[model samples]
Target: MDNKNRYSISDQSIRFLNKYLNSFSPTGYEREGQKIWKDYISSYVEKIVTDLYGTVVGVINPNNSPYKLIIEAHADEISWYVNYITEDGLIYVSRNGGSDHQIAPSKKVVIHTKKGLVNGVFGWPAIHTRKSLEEKKPNLDNIFIDIGAFDKKEVEEMGVHVGCFITYPDEFFIMNHNYFVCRSLDNKIGGFIIAEVAKMIIEHGIDLQFGLYVVNSVQEEVGLRGAKMISHAIKPHIAIVTDVTHDTSTPMIDKKIQGDIKCGLGPVIGYAPSIHKKIREFIIDTSKNKKISFQRLVSSRYTGTDTDAFAYSNKGVLSSLISIPLKYMHTTVEMVHKKDVEKIIQLIFETLKGINYSKEKFFID
Candidate 1:
């Protein structure tokens, strides 16, 4: 069997993708999701190392190589924190990590509590009762969730309280045949792609020149906290961070502001000051050489992804960002093209196979 024919995404991987995306992994709380990711990639890696705050790294060719490369993605999803429980047992929430209040109304939610998952729904006033001219939009102050509790006492009895993280219960599904739709595909798709890259390396029997660290970072929805801490711990020589970028072709999004990107157009490569110019060019070259389709996106001072964290780490790591085109980011219906997902996985896989360099030589040019 030919190498390319034998090595492609399998049914097992699709099953794992569905399972991983459906699991709750809110910012600052990603242990369970990380466990699922770690277990899936364990067979493909030489050894696995986890940090104090639950950043998981699957180290390949771990011979204490001075030159290390990292392929990373965040595991956490945007969520809401139970900020205030009203006397009527209504829960007002605060942003856990860019949670969209406008879309919260009528969506199903799961509040993570010590007692396990408690179901709830963001309740809104009936249109018949609201005066159109005086209607208020859903904001942090107005959006509330009802857990069918009549009063605060009932809510408390159900183990609901302030500071509990709430996530959407939306499961992964295929849309219009080629798009992956779910609530947190903003970055969980990234974790899945990195794992697929690892699987490719193992099945193809590719020998790596550097220690490859596949990192599933936590707390990215809040900030680049996980990537920041893990960068210091790994101190990699080169890093490729994958995340989601806006698909401005969708309705209501201005292409002039968000950049003109579309789903299924291939992986999007970010250009920013934080991205190392030398390594960025190397990745572009690799993509061209491999005949992979990719789009370019120019960013402001910071790329606003984990790339910034790794790029500005100790002594600076050569980092780049590869984003998948996503529609309706931060909403329950976040979507990404399946082909774009495959492109990113292929790009990273081919780049790793071609990166035969030392840290000293990388900085020379």
Candidate 2:
């Protein structure tokens, strides 16, 4: 596809991502986002179901393929919850997921309360007040959110209550021709990819021999909890976990320490023991045949994404990991290449087409 065609996909992905990312569905509170995903993907899939934990599963099976395949993505993002509302109305928050406190200071955030949405900024100690601790990075426990309310009564009147979810208020922005930045690309990109693949399967009228389940999991950022439940329920024969990996273009990271996966280099295929050797080879072969560029990533142990859950779910599944190279992971300004997104989707679609039920293999314990 040319740049124009690529942008079309990027534009659609960005539109869907922005709509879902701006929704107030942090880890344990993903009901709103789940509803949106169900509504959006219902038209394209054969059957859509929600697990007990609110994980959304979309199936597209044309020829009743014997093999069950899962493309897993997490819908949750890192966020904070109001733990205490002080007498002065400043809200102290507890981190909900794997949040990096270094990026919390002086950042804009949204407080999702029972009544309404409240805008706030994470405040850092003033320079004069921090003279003794100038070189120290403040911990998350010391951070507070200022919503411009003067007293506890005002905050209460504004519907700011304990347990309200708070997230960074960063809007999506296009950086270069194919690069874009957003707040929750950590896994929203994965959701977009699976949804688009479902749409393409329907549009092209391609029938797969195996059943394909596209899952938008919840609480992955917290502990990969959602995947564990859904994977057990589905008991897939093969699993592909899509998430963002580090893009080491910024300062402080050594290029050699991390593999040379860049934003526009296509998707990163993870090489870990948990990943099935045959499945990984098939993916690479498909990408090569389709002329899609991809990078090989080596993971020493367990990948800290949904792959960890799928690899060990219900006596284990043949699992592999594909990552979109993302710059500044876990921060408000996460960036990814639009071309890489398209390539990743294409790689996935092609891999689905290449699945054969008769060639199943097992790993020895």
**What number of clashing residue pairs does each candidate have, in the order they appear?**
0, 2
Residue pairs in candidate 1 whose N, alpha carbon or C atoms collide under 3 angstroms: none
What is the lDDT of every predicted structure here?
0.90, 0.83
Q: Whole-model lDDT for model 2 versus the true structure?
A: 0.83
**How high a TM-score does candidate 1 get?**
0.96
Q: Estimate, for each residue in 188-233, the C-alpha lDDT of model 2 and write its tens digit.
A: 8889888988877777677787788999999998889999999988
Each prediction's RMSD over C-alphas, in Å, is 1.8, 2.8
TM-score of 2: 0.92
Misplaced by over 4 Å in model 1 are 1-7, 358-360
Number of the predicted model whose TM-score against the real structure is largest: 1
What is candidate 1's local distance difference test score?
Answer: 0.90
What ranges in model 2 sit over 4 Å off? Answer: 1-14, 133-136, 359-365
Displacement of the residue 284 alpha carbon in candidate 2, Å: 1.0
Clashes of 1: 0
